[model samples]
Structures are given as C-alpha cells and as structure tokens.
Target: MSSVNTAIQLITREQAEQGATAKGSTCSPALAKGPWDYDLAEALAGIPAYGPGASSADVAPAATPRQGQLPEAYKLASDAELGERILAAKAALGDRAVILGHFYQRDEVIQYANFVGDSFQLANAALTRPDAEAIVFCGVHFMAETADILSAPEQAVILPNLAAGCSMADMADADSVAECWEQLEEIFGTEPDAEGRVPVLPVTYMNSSAALKAFCGEHGGIVCTSSNARTVLEWAFQRAQRVLFFPDQHLGRNTAKALGVPLEQMPMWNPRRDLGGNDAQALLDSRVILWHGFCSVHKRFNVGQIEKARKDFPGVQVIVHPECPMEVVDAADSAGSTDFIKKAIAAATEPTTFAIGTEINMVNRLAAEYPQHTIFCLDPVICPCSTMYRIHPGYLAWVLEELVAGRVVNRITVAESVQDHARTALERMLAARP
Candidate 1:
C-alpha cells in the first residue's frame, strides 16, 4: 500500500488512461494536483473556506485566518527538491526547532516531523524538547494554539500554513459560545444544588479554540481529548448537574451515550437560535447540552460505508473514530481515538483485515505500515481532512528554510489573558482520572 498521496496520484493517472470506471476510489481529480494550487486559490479568495478535500463544503466563519501565496520557488520546486530542502533546513536548525506532525497530515509533510501523533500528544511532545526555540506544528490552527499554550514562554509555535485551520474548531466561535453561556447562566443560575453540584458546567473538546477552553476554565469546566472524554465527562458530572459539550457533537454524543446518558437528556444547542432552539423545560431537564459542530472528515463516515466494508470482507474488524456519528459508531465493532486504533492494530499477533473510519491519510499510513494485514478506509473516496491537507511539503520546506535564516513565519501565539484560563482548564483535564 502506497502513501495516500502516492495512491491518489496513481489512481488519478490510471483513471485518466483507462477511464473513470477503472478506479474504485472516488476523490476529486483536483486532489491529484499539488495542494499549493489550492493554497494559492485560498489566498486569492480572501474569504473563509476550507480548501478542497472532505471539508471543502463546510462553511468557514469570517474570522478564519488566510495564508498568503507561497514563494514561487517553493511552488515550482519538485517533490524531491522540496524533500531535500526540508532535510537540509532541519539539519541546519539542529535542536533549535522541533517539527510536530498530526496524524492526519499528508505523508509528504509528515516525513519531516520529529514527532508525529495527535494534537494533544504532539503538544506534550513539544514539552519534551524544551530547549527548542521553535515548535513547528504541521497541523491546523487550533493545534498550534495548543502548543503555544503548553510550551515554554520563549518557545514559539509555528504553523507551516496559516490557512490550515480546523473546520470543527471554527464552528464554535468565542462570541457564539459566550452568548450560549449567558443564556445558560440565566436559566440554570450560578448556585450549586444541595448535593454541591452546579447547574451546568462547560466541557470543551480538545478540538475547540483556546477561548472556548478559557471559557470552560472561568466556569469551573474542564477540557477533554477523545481518549479521555469519558473520564472528563465523569469529572464534570461530579461537580455539575449538567454538562455542556462543544465543538464536535459526535464525540460528545458518542462518549456521553457510552456513559449511559439518554438521547432525550442530551439536547442540541444551535447558536443561531435563542435558548439554543430549545424550550426552557427541555434545557432544565437536560443532562448534557451538545453544541452544533462536527469534524467534516469524520462526518463523511456513515453506516452505509460500514455495511459495505462488512459485506466486502466478512471477518473484517471495523474500527472508527469517536468523532463519527452515533449510527456509524454503533455499527462499528469498536470506536476509539487515533492512539487506540493504532494500539489495537499493533496488539494483534496475527494478520487481520481492518476497515478503519477516520482521515484517509492516517488510515492509508496504517495500511502501508502493516503489510501483512489487509487494511482499508471505510470511505472508498480518498478525501482527507481539508485543513490537514493544506500543510503541503512545499509549505513545510518554506517554513523550515525561513527558520534556518533566523526568521519565523506563521507563528501562533495565544493572548496572555486567554492563556491563564485555558491552561487552567487543560490542567484540570490533566489531573482528571478515570
């Protein structure tokens, strides 16, 4: 199994030579082009939109940051050239810079990463290299923000492409969440019950913005990752009568449902409507208020895909991310975080078939790594997380070379005011146990 990028290119070329019917995978032919093309287009559009991929359809908020055109030299460089330049730049930078790549990032960019994992894991990885002056996060905007929050004051967190922003994180803005919080406060009041549980406590998924995490901290809430959501939610429930989970509804819903929270008790909160489009009685009766936000990539996985996988491979073990819809999760044999999925595959003593539902990049990487097993993505299409695709090798080479010249481009910094509260919320999460 080739890397997803190589596979996409091969599929695209084969399709062109033998007609569309020749290829089983369905992905935009545009994906076959260099991501720098979309990068340039996004820079020219001057509007908020996730570039081409799974999240291209997602409507970005007006506040989404945009990236300027890459220097022509980088855009014109061949893949081999970019790889050499990145390596040369890294060799020059030595320990002064540590590159962190997310699991969803393309293989082209991930090859240069000193540390590769999910966002939370990468952030913690940065802490291990404290002497590094720069943390180059090859993920999205929110991830870089997280590294900035957790890293030492002197360390600067840099995103290779500023346009690499998470669509799910953008779904829950600071203002919209603040408005929802005010309404909740009015309805639930600030006082705790006789059992010492407050009316509602905000709980933000790690995929959310820093300001959202700060909001959680200010209101006695905690942050959670997909792996620890159950523990965090249980932690929240111990101190609050109801929990408000945000940014990715699927993760919250799936995790809450696993914890025995009923469907009726978890009401969806639409930021556009007053009272989150729910009656006061419903709000009062809710045990968990879910925000209307989701991961575009995870949203692409469905029960139909799972059914198809099972039909194709009778004994296949189906594993999906918790960020997928409840129906998709319920249909799968197991749902867990990226780490869990990786560990499950690693733990298998014998070769086995797997149908994974997550970003195409990570799934394809797994398939490539485990040659003995037959592993495939649930979605036949090759669409990856749009934002993660934004960090192409060209951008990586450019950022790394810039660092070699004592210049930092696309540095992500959290405001001091938001930092304290956000760190507090994250700290609470770190201290939480199952």
Candidate 2:
C-alpha cells in the first residue's frame, strides 16, 4: 500500500486531545466513548487491520507492488507536470479509455477520473460505458475485479496500482470460507425448511474478491453493498433459514440488529479456529453468522470522538457509514453509505455543523465542497483509506500514457468460470436493489 501526498495531516486520538488541551479546551469526553485500541496514525501509512482471530498469517493472495520505486521521470515530475501528462494522455485516448475513481480517492486522482463515485456507483458506471475499450479504475483491486465482471468483454479493466486491496476483503480467504462452508453443511444439513428455503444462504459483501462472490452465486446467494445490505439480507431470508454473511461483520450485524436479530443470535466466525470458536448449539441458533472482518479506517472511529464533537460544537449532525462498529453507528446521529452521507450534507439548506465518521479523504472533500457548513471528521485524527490512497497521480499518469501508446497496463481479468458466477451475484444485487 502507498500513502498519498495530501495536505491533510492525520494525527492520533491522544495527540489530538493533547493539542486541544494545550489550546485551553477539552474534548476528551468524546475520546472516552470507546477504547482506542490501535494507533490511528498507522491508517495513513496504508496498514491493514485484522479481526480478533484472523492474523496476517492466514495467507491470502499477495498484493502487487506498484508503489515501489517509481520511474525517474515520475519521481522527478511536479504535481502539475503529472496532472498535465494525465490530461494529455486521456485526450489522446479519447473515448477509447474511461477513468473511474472512488469517492475516497485523493483529489489529484479523482480529478483525472471521468466518473467519480462510491463502489456501487462505479460498478454501474463501467456498465454505462460499453463503448470504452479500456476502463482505468482508480480504486482498490476488488473494485477493478468487479468492473471486469460487470463490463463488456471487450473492455479492459485496469487498476492503476495493483497493490491496492481492501483489508476487510483479505480477512476471508477462499480456502477458509470453503472449510467453513463444509462445517456449516455438516451441522445444518443440505435440506430445506417446510417453506422450501435452504437451511443456510451465503451472503458476501461487495468488498470481497471475485472468487468469493462467485462462491455465493454458485450456492444460491447474492452480493451486497453497504447501500443495499438490508435489502439483500431480506432477499436471502426469503429463500433460506439463516444467512452466512462474510468479509464485513459490522455491516451484517448492524443490518441484522436493525431487522430485529438479537446480538446473541449473531456469532462471529474465527477462521483460524474450528467451528469458528463456537459451540454447535450456538451455531444452530444463529440467525446471521458474522465473519471476522472489518474496515481498518471505519474501526478507528470511536464513540468517544462523536461525543466529544457534540460537546465541542452544539447541535452538530453526526453521520457515519454502516461499516462502522454498531456502538459507534448507534451513537451517531445517523448511519448510511458514503453516497448517503454526501447527500445528507447536500440536502441541508441552512449552514450546519457536521461530524462525519468515515474516511478522512471524503470528509475533507465534503468540507471543502460545502463551505457554508462546518464539516469535520468525528475522529479528530486523520486516517484516510490506505488502499484507496494507493492509486497515486503518478500511477494514473503512467497507465493513461500506456493506453495512449496503444498498450494496456495493469489490466485486471476474471476467469470465465469465476466471471460467470460473479456476474450472477452482481445481477442479483442489481435486481434486489430497493
């Protein structure tokens, strides 16, 4: 993973508290909301976070090292020079190339994107450009894989930085999931209920790999994004006795909890241990079996920070993404997907104060866009999505230049077998959208 050269300086919670106290003010009340278990500053350095039982030793596919040792020309070029080169390459390629960027991407990279949006929107954005010969994705690896699965076969999906990957996605490997599935079948059996619903249904979050999505589709399951998680789960329940949700425990738990599923009924699956460290009885009674996975950036946000923001600024509207822990999501004013957060601010007519609990890059961008409102991150520390920042302007320029030279660089392709099943899951999601 790589770090972005942005103007924002991310600090730790402790550092923020000390700085505030030195200014003759106190915001520690918010800091007291939850335990600051990890160093928030490490997020800016592009470090991934593992779940309770999952370790780096779990051994997923290694990330491509695009961030290491840039070419001399790119290393020496100024920001302006790189920006000009990117623009020139795009102009030369014309309609043959299309650049898609995630909202969490840096301004430098986002500026070059022909379409800028969240994951769901970017997936659909690729579909809208079938005439494009190449889709240059300025996001993480899985996202590019998704675009490849959804886009036309003639379209080449390229991730500018191959090293860019989701920490949460890496938590659940295909082999571990396969073993878990076998164990689950052994306990639950392959029979359907009286209503003709299967004993269990597999539901994977969009942040996961194409292979995982294919697994879900092959097993009569569906893929879900944060925006449509609730709907996808509802769809799953219609045809299954219980849902096996993976790659993002928080989203599954949060959505299930809201739908009246008790916390006691949601058991976490620790891939490193047998039966996921749970007894058979608990597994039998479970409604949503949560895989041990979480977003490092969202997990860093604490309720203490939210409470402190409210204490410092009166009537502050606190908003967060559903990927956050249930406690933090519950403590905030509202929770939704990234697009929802952006719209919430856009819909406000009067000047407002917002305390957002998501990535720092999006928060900072929103703050700049909505000058009328005082928008700041709930987490006083600056922690952008490390993987999202891996798509630097230099990489963007390099890929675009290659495309202009009648060459495709860093193209991502899914196997026909995997693509067929992954597309099935994605199509289910599109149709299941509320």
Q: Which candidate's lDDT is highest?
A: 1
Query: Per-residue alpha-carbon lDDT of model 1 for 1-434, expressed as tens digits?
Result: 66788877888888988995776664576777876677677667766678778988888887788887889999899989998999999999999999999999988888889999999999999999999999999999999998999999999899988888998998899899989988999999999999999999999999989999999988899999999999999999999999999988999999999999999999999999989999999999999999999998999899998888888899999999999999999999999999999999988889999999999999989988888899889988888888888888998899889999989999999999999999999999999966
TM-score of each: 0.98, 0.88
Pairs that collide, model 1: none
Off by over 4 Å in 1: none
Tens digit of per-residue lDDT, candidate 2, span 1-434: 11223333222343465664432222222221111121222234445332111122233344423333445676567789998999899889998989998989877788788898998799898888889999999888889999999888889999886667777888887889999999999999999989999989999999999999999989999999998999999999999989999999999999999999999999999999999999999999999999998887788788899889999999999999999999999999899999999999999999999999888778888998899999987776544565675567788888889888888878899999999998899899989968
Backbone clashes counted, model 2:
3
Listing every candidate in turn, what is its Cα RMSD in Å to the true structure after a full C-alpha superposition?
1.2, 6.5
Task: Please report, in order, the local distance difference test score of every candidate based on alpha carbons.
Answer: 0.91, 0.81
What is the alpha-carbon RMSD of candidate 1 to the true structure? 1.2
Clashing pairs in 2: 30-304, 30-308, 33-304
